[model samples]
Target: MNIKKHAVITTVIFALNAPVWAGEASFIAELASTTLPQQAPVVASISTSNTYFMTSAPFSANSSAAITHQPQPDPAITLPQLIEKDWWGALAEITVVLVIGELLYKTGEESMKEDFDYEIEGNTGRYFVDRIVTTESWKLDDNEVGMNWGHAYAGALYHQAFRNYNFNYYESMLGNFLTSGIWEVFAEYKEVVSINDQIVTTFGGSVLGESFFQLSEMLDTKEGWVPATFAGVFNPSKTLRGWFSDDTANRFDRQQSTDQFDIYTGALYSTKDTADISTTTMLLGVKASIDSVQGQYDALSATPSLVELDMELGISAEGIEDWQLSSSLFLGGYTQEVKPTTGSRESWGHNWFIGPSMGIEYSSLGQEDEEDFFAAINVIGLSAGGEWQNADFNISVRGDIFGDFSMVKPFASKDYQASGGQFWGTKSVLWEGGYAYGLGHTAKLTLKQATENCY
Candidate 1:
């Protein structure tokens, strides 16, 4: 009986102390509010309907006061958010990606380096055992043009020559794949050079240090070869490129349940000696991408002879590994050609690319030790959209249905646009391939020994 009575008393006391616990929590919250100014209350006034400084004012409020309130907060953001926001964060991500890509390219390079590693055999042009992995193998007739178009001749010992290398590391840098590492580096030196009237080109060059640093993230990842979102900078060198480029983006975003919106603008300016006058271009854009693939429009206009509006419908799945597909119907009216207009000249055209694409990636292969790789294919007319590879070789093919996309001014504008307008609708094709031996594999004999023994 005594034990039961004691238990009941303890239970009653515990229940009575529950209010004390609540009181302690209230005290701590009040203390925190008082200590942190940023955490102070935001008192909204009835008459002004504006939120004002609440710290210096008295803590008294009338029962009939119509003021509302909320707590203020500290200004700092989390690290992950900061990383997604700052350019430095982007640099770090790119660096890590580059290092990995470099390693993968080297892995492939080593497997095939020996095929061409040995010296020439008997001074014959043919390499009996070109350890150089053949990325591409094929035959071309007169219809096809070699990457470099030039003439080659030879003299006894002394000769003078000149040649162009179409596809090399330097040229590759101008493309979308910035983190291509050695491929980029190799391309840099892939030029046809002439000596003694004979022209020769080899893929033995290295990438520039600056180029490597800029495209770091694209280095090691499977999708690293995709073009970066950033566009190329326009300069005097590209005055003849036919495309007007400016460093800017039209940005628009908004919060829900409000008509208010935010708009941001950007620009770039430069001057060159050959260029007679300095020009300032203003890019103005306003837009919002809707969740549904119905319709979206972005337009920009400023200065004389500059006006553009693009309307597009974009569709994207929201989830891990979800792919995005978009089609834009473009209508452009160029008040003046990218080049300054002289005499009454007007050019206007509308072009559209209806490209649909899908991609998938597997993180784990059945074999535990095997590395993960992704494969995707896209078709732009005759151009095979994605890249293809096996253990021994890799191939990438690209071609425009018509040569309309060609950067060079092939023919006269009147003649070309009239005749070449078909070229845009016509098709051009590009194919590239690479073959390499498996890792740690090597040929035991030199080219001379291998050739002699075969006979």
Candidate 2:
């Protein structure tokens, strides 16, 4: 068994959300929920990045640099404030993007040049009807990466359109529902609606989309150019239209949210390669999270309460070679907090939450001869993890364990479809979208660490 050690000297500055949930921890059984956007948060910054934060602020830590917030009530944002926006403009923005993408896909690609060559013996209406009739649960034609991760990225685009106009979560999802539905129903009129695309796009946009949109909001509440750029990258629509351009001051809910985010960058040395190709590389990562844990929560509701997304990219001298994206949304549940007994040694804040949750995680690394090693999608399952925090040095260690029914492709084999030929310069877009598909019941384990100024 070859051993690999990852040593990272990271400047985790932007969104402090290390792979592990921050000080937001309560008890495992009573821990996660969200606070609505009541009072808008205030922005503060320090050196390197936006490091200066007020004490008791959710973004602060026990150490001078890292801190946690205490829950409190503030103002209420009326529905009218949320609904007041140019909805039509947002819709058009989304439509234009989808239309152009599909048009280019069908008209531009050589393989898709025969895009409308459907097997129909009738006119357009009949072809449309028959196309709908023949659509299955999923379209197998698209590569696994596109279905699993790419569609979701596309979905985030739809979710952000409405969010840019100041739309709330459910409303943004409404937009996602409508936009993705249209794409399935008419956007790519010639090709049959891709059921998998519809589901992945909609759901991924709902979870990932909202996460990034809120991430934009979170970053906006901070004072710095670096955080500002990230805010734009996550929600380009809002960025293009000029951020917070109106009276909508309630976008960043610092008053009610129990979220803390930070940018992560590091280095790793590892030798677990099945093909004996040990490697070392630098890392850069960011996180999108909101209300992951709090004082009170109700799991009985179907609305989404918590969204936690963590990503880590490995960069070798050759370029980015490995990465991981893990996201989870609390379907619903309640929170239980065991506050530090009046004046105890600050070690008594215990909280926990139990509720339904849905998530998607994809990790691609290592290589077995000519084929690559991959793990993608945990369709349905439960995961448990633990975290440790230190107050003096402002250090945190987080570990994640996953077990579930998954859709995975084990390796490069003649048995499945080819998935890695599309190229972008020296690398391949095929790497972005991995190889074939298969089913398996698998389990995985991952560990990560973060500190105030560790490199």
TM-score each candidate.
Answer: 0.19, 0.66
Per-residue C-alpha lDDT of model 1 across residues 1-455, encoded as one tens digit per residue = 02243442342243234324323432333343344443212111111112111111111212222222322321111111111123343344435434654575457665534323234456332332221222121111111122211110001000100001111112221211222222222321221111100111111001111112112212212132222221121011112122455622212111100121112344424344542433333333322121101011110000001111111221212112211111111111111101111121231111111121111111211111121221111111121122222222333332223111011112232344446443432322111111000111111111111211132
- Quality of model 1 by C-alpha lDDT: 0.20
Where is the poorest 10-residue window by lDDT in model 1? Answer: 153-162
Q: What is the C-alpha RMSD of each candidate to the true structure, in Å?
A: 32.7, 12.1
Report the C-alpha lDDT of model 2 over 1-455, residue by residue, as the tens digit: 22111210111110123112211111111122123333322121111121111123232322332123443322122232333456787878887778776876667557653434344456878666555554332243344454446777878898778766655544565677667767765656645465445556655556677677767777888788988898788888777767457643544445546666778888889875454567888988877677734412221221245667888888887766777887866543334333333322344343444444556666766433333445444333443334433432222222233333233443544233445533344222234344433434445455656553454
lDDT of each: 0.20, 0.51
**What is the lDDT, from 0 to 100, of the residue 133 in candidate 1?**
27
Which ranges of candidate 2 are over 4 A from the true structure? Answer: 1-80, 83-90, 114-121, 133-138, 144-148, 165-171, 295-303, 367-407, 412-434, 439-455
What does candidate 2 score on TM?
Answer: 0.66
